[model samples]
Target: MSVTNQTTVTEFILLGFPGPSSLKLTLFVTFLAVYLLSFMGNTLIMFLILMDSTLQTPMYIFLGNLSFLEIWYTTATVPKLLATCLLETVTIPVSGCIAQYYFFFSLGATECILLAVMAYDRHVAVNRPLHYSVLMSIEICLRFSAGSWTGGFIAPLLPTILISHLNFCGPQKIDHFFCDSDPIFKLSCSDTFLAEALGYTCSSVVILTSFLVTMSSYGKIVVTIIKLSSREARKKTFSTCASHLTVVTIYYGTIIFAYVRPPAKYNFTIGKVISVFYCVVTPLVNPLIYTLRNKDVMKAFQKFLAQKRFLLTRNMHKF
Candidate 1:
């Protein structure tokens, strides 16, 4: 293959949501609010997991890792998107754009594996109740969590490196909020057949494999739940998995719609809307779902608040 002359594209102007000035401000404010809430929610989960001794189980440990991933995942792209909404023309340097794409996808891949690991954890908890503690010991949980992080970080490296080396001759305006692989690849002037092939191959392997594992774990969980004689037992068991199932459904649904297809068939507007759901909405809602549905989390939160109030009252009396 003959090498095309490398493009002089130094920066990419992000053509964020195209609309009236009022719409821009509205989007900016909306995204800013979402980002802030996502940040706070994830941070709170991490903090609670760290502070509450009762939450030192394998489930919460995995959750803490997930919260950490969510914080950085949203951080990778949301701020830049917010900036583009506010500024008339927001340009990211080529290197910065590449880095953003790499991290965004890497973090997302990490979440994918993490979710599957969470499913397996739940499966073992429900299926092997007698050996739950033994099966999911601290060391084992750490290994699973570490594997997710490592796999997530390494999964996109090859594709990202391949795409980065491709030539972008001109037309550096990306018609989306962030520097995603599809948008960036579209801008490349070089022959992108190999890059595209590699991307699809990697995505299929990561997404399909992780998704299958999660589904299989849930499948076994469903079978085990069915064997429970008491309605209450079954209901309680289902509740434990409910929040995770909801999150997995929303996350994988949006991701499958967005990336698991040929780029030629991609609808930019639809993709952007779905991207907002997974990228912006899911992270914000995850903690809410888990905390609200979880009795333990609620009890812990109330206890934390009560402790703070008691401390304040005592301090005031002393003063």
Candidate 2:
């Protein structure tokens, strides 16, 4: 082994979205719209849930947590992406790079688990309506919300630890939009069997477990709803479950494609597109999925806004 062989690693470069000068302007606009909507929509949803006591149920409690996660989730990448568009080039330090991926990984993982928790919440609410108060009390709500965040933190520490054992050689270019595990692992010069194995195992456990739990919960819910509730009530209950199921499918499908498979070399364009689906698109779509389908949330939002306006006017008159 020569010195060149011995010196196997340095730094990695991230290549964000590619386009012409005019296209950067277009990308800038599109990214701005996504960032704004993701922020405003999620914030509004959480605000409504918090202000309206009627929305203080277990389901909306999880929704509020999901909305809060969206804020940090999008913030992890969107601002950097927007800055890259403006500066036309950007370099994140290695330390900053790892930290960025840390929180990004955590939040993404938490969201994956949170969606399943939300599914369970709906199942319990609809299927076991009688025990809803006893089962999903405030304590259980807090525990599940905290559990999702805890799992998020726990899931990625293994990968990061395994990554620490490897050294980087040359080939510093990361061929994707952001610093994801797939591209990061690809850039390493060392044999990546251990790291890759861990990646696949973790993805399977996190996603497959969540999916199984959601499905099992829903299966019980369906039978329970039909037996106990009126036809109209059953229809109303399934509507919310269906909407949640749709969002879960879309979000997890993209995630499975990107992360669940065995790690290998990836094409730049394909990776970028898949990354956008999980990162940019999911944050933008999740809030809409719930708000558009659920009338209870809509009514709660109206009530919250009306109360706020009333208070503001009252304060103004007092002044």
* Global lDDT of each candidate: 0.89, 0.79
Clashes of each: 0, 4
Error of 2 at 168 (Å): 2.4
Q: Write the per-residue lDDT of candidate 2 for residues 1-319, one digit (tens) a residue.
A: 1235455544556667777778777888998898899899899889888778888888888989998998899888887777666665566655566677778878988988998898888887876779989989989999999999999889978876787666666566766656777777776767778877886688778888887888788888788768854788778767878877887888888877777765654566887778777778888887888888889988887777788899999999999
lDDT string, candidate 1, 1-319, tens digits: 3335655788999987888889989999999998898899889889888999998899999989988999999988888788888888999998999899889988999999999999999999999989999999999999999999999889989988988888776888998899877888888887888888888778778888999999999999999999999999999999999999999999999898888888678777777778889889999889889889988878878888999999999999998
Model 2 residue 316 lDDT score: 100
RMSD of model 2 against the true structure: 2.6
Worst 10 residues of 2 by lDDT: 1-10
TM-scores, each model vs. reference? 0.97, 0.89
lDDT of 2 at 296: 90
Runs of candidate 1 with Cα error greater than 4 angstroms are 1-7
